[model samples]
Target: MVAKEGYRNGKRALVLLVMTALLLAACTGKEDQGKQEPEANKPKEPVELSIWQTVLNVNEEQFMQEYGSKIKEKFPEVTLRFIPYKGKGSAIQDLIAAGQMPDIIYASVGHIFFGVLDPQLQFDMTELIKKNQFDLTRFDPALIERQKQMANGGVYGLPTSMDTLVLYYNKDIFDKFGLSYPKNGMTWDETYELAKKLNRTEGGVAYRGFGMATGAMFTVNPLSLQSVDPSGDKARFTADEGFKKLFENFSRFYNIPGNEVTQQNITLAKQRELFDKDKVTAMFVNTGAFASSTYKDTMNWDVVSLPSFGETPGVGSQPIPTYFYIANPSKKKDKAFEVISYLTSNEFQQYAAKQGRFTSLNDRSIRSVYGDDIPYFKGKNVKSMFPVKNASPTPLTKYDSVALASLGTQFDQVLIGPKDINTALRDAVEDANKKIETEKGK
Candidate 1:
């Protein structure tokens, strides 16, 4: 059930239910799409594999369950039961506490710190990779890099999908203002001037230059107000002048009189209600926003790279990968790995790319999966994300949630009050360092 469109498509790649009863029967005839097996004279009993993944949206949930049916044809004897959960963290927590961990679990990039940051929670998959003779070379190099960092050669997880952040802008507004489309290398200064210039005042219906998620807070990582130096594991958010300069630019846009935003219908639903209404000039959003923007087919929009600071090369944008990990507690580790391999393999990723989800694991196959040009990407500037490549997680101790909340509190202070940028930054840096030091001692 693959639906193809001009730019976007959907692959309801489904496996027949009958094929599940005869796993190897169809494989003997079909070419090796995945791993090739030497014919064994004796047949072993099939294993039942229980899997769990968080259902954040309708499309993703459907892809998982529906794809499961298709993979069943290749391994009919192996049963895959996918249990749905809500938050990635909560799902894993509940499963762990209940002593009912699934063989495989879908994990968000944000939640990866919870597993990899803690050594005890992770299962060393190095042996499993060797025993199965799993070719680590099959995965994308970027995916392999992150996995190596987290696993420390343990190979605990497989990246399923990749998501990148870009600046989404309205086309009608650009046309009305007689402004040219945003270029890939636009700097923050240029973007700001354009935003200020394009703000139409004809009807006294003031429009904003940009709208950012005030609620989304991060003190570290590439998306944060600060970041660690990739070369050194040291917190450079405060020390790094580059980050400070970026923050200054960020604050300047928000400080604009009309740009001061709150979480109204205008704020919460950024692209749909705000940008589409021609109120906002641009927004920093993920690839998912493209889907929602075009579902109505009324909004004419384009994407560009995020703005950069003065002399530094435009850092481009940051993209996070969607991936899944198998738990060691499962009784069916072998079957679990097989299911994971299938889902993250080029075949399944190609199926997902048809749905317009951001995919980077197998770009060659995605090129074949999609048509010449996707309207969602039409006229949109596509820039590679640099932040994701250099991103490092913030300290995640037992009190990580508390530390984040504290950071949020401080951010609110700066957002609401009249505080000098230097003072605020110094205070935040000192406080965060103190906390990190305390955590390290613990």
Candidate 2:
């Protein structure tokens, strides 16, 4: 009877052990299945990234036709949707109010510098730049430095196109006056002397020597020159030595014997007519004006580096760069950065250069091949667009636009003989300070 009882207990213990083992195996299988399910059900679709550009001329359909295929060839799993916003105020503001923030924002350095597009609204690209080992040296040092300044020492954007000030001369006018073409790397003083030679009344019609578009006189100066001090809420243009020098240099051109007609007399609208239709203007200081189709078939023109100030010998004018900024609120930041990287890549820059678009890259090979694909640029001195260093961007204040306009009016007064340089500058300072205070009150 004792032997039978011991066998029964052993049998019951084996049955309990088998049940426990089966229960443990079931729990382990569920966990394993849970882990594999996510992988098995992962989405296999491509992500679509939206990009917004404020400029009207930039067509998305044209972009997709020209460059979209190249991007797709590289990143098949990513798609780009380009959105064009043509409006007055800040396009970013409109987008934010409408809750339509895109993955990328296209803007000018002026817009970014002046706080139109808030820097905090952009993702700091410094980390991604380091992770991807991007060669910042591939671009002009001034351009990279400008980006840093705009972001307060953080790289928040990348430049797509760089437009620098150049001296555009009418070949016909130069030839008619028996003067040689303006050479690259000439100083403002040397250029002024050349302008004197070209300023004359020919065939009973007045032909001005040298003329610049309204408001472009500021471009030739250093970026540090500002009309107002944001920190102190004061006007700096009156006391700033840079402004004094700028006024003096520009005054020399208009004060010439026959060229004293003043910009107000001719007006901005007539300035282009003078250059294009009348052909009375000999040398003009402009940026990207010669690239227009209006001049492609009509005029004989060539460009040279802008006349530099003797104080800043080798440095040319500040570049007007168009920047591409990544949205800070984007869910596809990594993908957006990839697109920006590809856009600024060597292959893309070369393609852009061929389209007659100025590339921001400092690559000599790309500069050599600039505008080669465009038939209008054939036999033109396209290589002359480069060779000079871009001037550093000036720091900006919130009141810069108003202050600059006020100061510009004062400068115009000086040019038109309504006020002397000192009085005009003093009055401009008071006017700018008042405007700044008004803006602060608002």
Candidate 3:
């Protein structure tokens, strides 16, 4: 009986020892599992990208509200710092000179020459685009083509929004004048006749019939005239016959006995104030219609497709697009590319379009949602925000802005001075070519 009891004790001890060994091995495996994860599964290192745009009067907070927050929600790893242009001290040149150039820059088609390309801030995004397999076809083909042309066949940027001309007419003015409201498909000639009827005085107020943005006729002409040729680095004011037609067609608007498009009224602000605040201007044509303008609360207005040129019956104003550019000085090129690329994604584009910034995408569904969320656009004819078709783009170069300025000088010369179209065009071509040569040097 004693020998059997001792053997039982030894068997029990061996079972207890085996259970302890197994428990130790299980704990060791758990400790090994608690180590750092594999590189592929690891959290991305944080990166902050700084942005600087030519958008003045808009503060950093406004930019973050409109744009930066959208980028942050998608990329928690990225922090965005918007550098605002406060004055000459914070200007693009000032920033670049201080060696404080930002990682990203923003500007529209017309300003890109001064804001990006001329400053040598443009970084060719081609390789980053190829590496990331970004599909440029997602954007409006016209926008992509313009972007390519803007860089002389190299893409330095991607579009964020689009703008085109529209005819903005105050409902009150038309009602008071007892004229039919402006219709979308009317020719410029037809619209001119309408403006003529409204050119009159009411209660001693001198209500002008029409006013225009100084750069509008020059930039968004239905005639597809570029102030300068893209590759030749030469001005086109006198060379292209379109200039004569363009000058003649609009020159008549100013000739009305009672309604003259004044020199100061040539400014967009002057036109907007005359149309919106003064409520005296009968017809005004420009981009950033009531929905995006400051006087949204002041005016009862609606839009039509920018009056068609009789020659190009269905053509609309040239598309003016805004782009996001990554700077050559960007240390975070890969991440910066990712940031701008993601902004073009359907999700972000849809969100922005709803807020009244027109989509850069080719998606009609997205385009249809423009201004859905803006208070000013409620019940407004937002469809008129688009023309029958965006006017086919003309090739552009860095010198076009200079030429456009020259054209503005000539526009005033013809309207306010004795210069005719031929004389004005000749002087403009000479002045632009000379200035362009200076631009080339600097």
Candidate 4:
């Protein structure tokens, strides 16, 4: 009986030992699992990003030659695919319908304001900007503010380059008239006085003092002048005194004696021909007009700061910036931001400056290198483009394009004396509201 009891005890002890060994193995396995490498430290697979631009043709060669290589060198695992499409039509919509949504988009401020690129589809970049520690101060303050305003206080995109309206004057015309060149930082009143002196009949040829492109007058106005209020769904120009003043300011150029007929019928092409081919216009108030082929080797021209209004003295026209926005549908947002941040970096901006493209960076060093590669701008007052303060961005609404179009048509009526300033503005407000209501119903 004692031997049997001892055998039972030995069997029980062996079972206990086996159970203890199993428990130890299980705990060791759990500790090994816990010690596994973190996912963040692991290498990520390569990614290909797509970028679409309406004006890619203009910059394609430069991008391939300069930016493309830089991107490859910096991100060897990433591939950039640039696709260009027609700017004016439904190409982008077709692409979206086909499920080929781009990871990034590049366009001008007009594109966003006119609803060509849907702002709602853009990723709010405020968080990305904060996370990346990207400095907004590096760019022009006005540009940053404009982007913020368009996004309704959210930064949806960033400007890559900025262009402002400047006074482009034909030196030969100024000399022939024996009038001094328009000075930088001149007020609209002062400029008009100068224009009066330049508008005259010289040997059966009409020498107009001043002319601006259609829709260019808005650039010189205060930021408060908006055509419509999308949020309120109302016209903003009817009761605004600024709109009246703006109309009067622009019409004075046409009201000059002997200039009435030409100003009433003049088109943009005619204005360019007057400045470039005919060389009769004393001054052309436009943005970057000197860079056009019209001024190439034809007329001796110079640029001065755009005329400022009494309301915002010393402030030039608002910056029309070219912006790049990342798509909300992009799966690779972080990577897209990385590329955008790099593209807007000082290094890239300097290269852009060298390529004669105006940079958005407010760096004096970058500005110093602008137009270095282009012989056309060698002796020009390229620096005149920088010194003045940018005009506040025009408050935009959903129906900005329609409203502006209506206003522009009425403005022409005012110039031709068919309608008074107040009547034209009232009619414009009515027309714009009607259009906006129709669009909303759709």
Per-candidate Cα lDDT values, in order, are 0.56, 0.76, 0.82, 0.77
Candidate 4 residue-wise lDDT, 175-218, digit = tens: 88677877787888998888888887879998888888758666
TM-score of each: 0.72, 0.83, 0.87, 0.83
Residue pairs in collision within model 1 = 7-374, 9-354, 15-70, 317-385
User: How many clashes show up per model?
Assistant: 4, 1, 0, 0
RMSD of each: 16.6, 6.4, 4.1, 6.8
TM accuracy, model 3: 0.87
For residues 1-442, could you state the per-residue lDDT of candidate 3 as single tens digits? 9999999999999999999999999988898887759886788899989898886777878888778888988888888888888777888898878878799988877778678877888888888888989899888778888877766677999998888877888888888878888887889899889888988887999888888775876787777787788668899888868898888888888888777655766566776788777889888887854457555656888877788878778687788888999999789988998888888889999998888888888888998888888887788777555776778788877677788998888888788767888999899899999999998898
Clashing pairs in 2: 223-394
Q: After superposition, how far is residue 103 of candidate 1 from its true place, in Å?
A: 0.7
What lDDT score goes with residue 371 in model 1?
A: 19
Global local distance difference test of model 4: 0.77
Shift in Å, residue 350, candidate 3: 1.5
Candidate 2 per-residue lDDT, tens place, 1-442, comes to 9999999999999999999999899999988887785763665469998777666566777667555777787677877787766565436677677777788877776667432345357678999899999888888877888777656788889887777767778889889988999888888999999999987887898888888764655733544476667679788876657888888898789889887765555465576677777888888877764664456757887777788877776567777787888888898888888888998999888887787768888888888887888776777776775546777666656667777777788877887886888888888889988888898897
